[model samples]
Target: MWFSALSALWLAATAWAAVDRGEDGNIRSIALRTHTLKQPYLDSDMSSRWYDFGGDTVIRTDSYIRLSSDRPSQNGWLFSRVPLTATNWEIEVEFKISGKNQLYGDGFAMWLTKERGQLGPVFGHTNNFEGLGIFVDTYKNNRPGTVFPYVMAMVGDGKTPYNKDNDGKETEFAGCSARGIRNANIPTKLRLTYFQDKSLKLELQYKTEDEWLLCFETNEPPTIPSVTYLGFSAETGELSDNHDIISIDAKNLYTTAGSSTPSKKTPGRGGASKLAKQKEGGSWTWFFFKIIFFILAIGGGYVGWTAYRTNQKRSHRF
Candidate 1:
């Protein structure tokens, strides 16, 4: 069994060693509809059950969810109502951005944040966010040695603000310049994958239909919020573009070999901290159980001794 497990790991590593930093072909995953949105997005009452929309967001049942159209000072958002409880997960977002003008400013963002459905300067969401933000920037703010329509990730700590002038140059942890990402023939899509304390990777599917090009991967994932919410937000200033989200496929990735603990969290709880608390609680339970067993054992021993004494007395009487 050990040998088989080692071989499986070796094969997965070898697959990742390929030219493209695509997903490990052997990895197992299941789609999570709680974090997914597609065509005919809204329910019968013209409201989405799993997601919430805000700002100037417009929902078209037959087509896409238009976050913002080709107009100036536009802001729109789509945020999941529930928190993502999976320990490890992947989110694939299909979207399109296009405009008649040669110039376009602002862009969109994919988020796993503690603060959702809030509006601000950071791509229709708030600054000083409490989780992960992957910005698909269409305009070049002031990034040197990089081009526009870039993809960058930032992990916010709820205190530091996003530098709109510097285009998040201050707090960005991982990023890549995705040229021609604003308007792609195959429709631009990005896949963000995160494994707790392991790795966080982003891939783009703009070049071809099925080919996913790697944007970046970091071995040490940033500190994610204990209870994260899925969200997408977009904003446009003077330069405008039509930003639309066609479909979204969210999945919870896990390995079959080991049991994947769901990251169930309350307001004051966290993942690792909660696990530690559970362990501590279990130890106390066992400690009490052992004491009870010891007491029961002594009680049985005393009862047996008393019966033996009574038997001896009865025998003498006989």
Candidate 2:
């Protein structure tokens, strides 16, 4: 009986060790197909890869994708169709936030998660969600002396609620408050890197010097499940900003199966895996709206030109 018990314990330890470390003492490296989000409406192919939610969100000027409007109580979300199937990967994003004036409330969140479009009080997506969330909070929800425009990260286990009242201090795994993330001369950049061995690192380019500031690194196992979605969400209470996502680059850092870790294979035939297939709605309305918006914009430009010409002629006569 003692021998049997000892064998069981040994088996459990071996399993834990396997899950806790990378293959061959290091995570395998891989190359992933890049998905770029820019201009002329999200392509139908990209529509197949990305999901947009909320009324105020839109793609504008054939390039920038606006995630939210500068309106109170408004919220918006965009999720990638691709799932981070591999254990080790990196996602980099270039984004900008601007508004007519200074006041901005709530903030924006970038997520690598098991949940999609689940809206709630925390940054437009649900709290207690499974996976990791990196938030660029633009408003100060805490006391008078606290910093504004904070960047923070939280890892969830699908059961713990984020402490929204205290600005996530209670639930934050790691974070930093960056003052100039919004309205910068150059777009703000963030990179998230995760390894199978459980090191999660974040780098930020909040200034124009082209340097990456290390926010924080943690050794905790990314409690998120194997299959997860990549998404962004934003919310506004009394204040708001025009949150624009310029680009997103997701790269798989580990090699496909047949390496030392043959058990963990890339999803599907490609290095990137599609978000678990979900029913998508028609895009005719979106198509028509884009057409009308462009038409009106052109007409408005013509009218302004004609008016300016008339004024110039009158001035010459005088």
Candidate 3:
């Protein structure tokens, strides 16, 4: 049994090693786009690779492409200049949303559509698109029982309106509420994987410090036509936030392993601050607090008992 396990591991490792990863460690991708979003003339320098549409969208040197802010009625989109040519592709992006308004909203979106810069109702873009729309909905447009910061996906056939009142429950192919994503101490990571006609998977790390949580996966045939562009859009209505995309890494999967299944580290791992994990979920600090609280409670009881005993002894002496 041990020999068989070792052999299996060896075989998998060998197969992985056989694939060619170029000098940049990018495997089999025909086109790779990586941007830190930190140049003075970013819009110009990236004009050939990216385009910004709508209002109040700015590229900041501090490390993000700002889509929209707390400003009401603000809407914008940043799109890829070139189409996603690869049949199987993966895109990883680090993003965060923070601003005033405790009841923040209209959220953000990531798109793989046949068209670009078309704005309408679906998170600042036109509805009925002919591709995939991944919504990182921050506010509760509807659905009272559901939590905020819901992440959902919809395949557009260029017709159906995303039922926002139901929180897209009607149109949503798959979705889940991802708490701790907005204003996370560390940027949340969003990874999307589409393997041709096989499957589409979405993973979200509420906090950069945590492991990727598989939000949802669907095997339904994508209603989207050939994806021509990739981009992000955001809007603000009564509520708002600073929707920012820190960085994006897009890669073609077909080149790396022809018709191969998705790998364990499909989008690769992230290096985030350890302290950030505490903000999202319980950590060593939680245990430490429990221990300290227990000790303090015991000490308080002991002190009270000692004082009471002393008072009784004094009264007896009297």
RMSD values for the candidates in order, in angstroms, are: 15.4, 25.2, 19.4
Considering lDDT, where higher is better, how would the candidates rank from best to worst?
1, 3, 2
The sequence of per-residue lDDT tens digits that candidate 1 reaches over residues 65-86 is: 9888899999999999999988
Give the best candidate by lDDT: 1
Top model by TM-score, which number?
A: 1
- Worst window of 10 by summed lDDT in candidate 3: 266-275
Model 3, 1-318: lDDT tens digits are 434654675676577556645322333543464322223426445553354555568876656778897788888888776677777777888888898667888899999888788777778888878888999998786687888789988888877778877778888788888888887877688988777777788999866576889998766546556646888899888888989887777776653322244333333342232233334335444765675567557767777898999999999999
Better of 1 and 2 by TM-score: 1
Off by over 4 Å in 2: 1-31, 34-36, 44-55, 143-146, 255-318
Candidate 1 has its poorest 10 consecutive residues by lDDT at 17-26
TM-score on alpha carbons, each prediction: 0.73, 0.67, 0.69
- Give one digit per residue, the lDDT tens place, for model 2 in 196-290: 76578888997865788888776664566788888888888878888888777776666434333223334573333212111111243356457
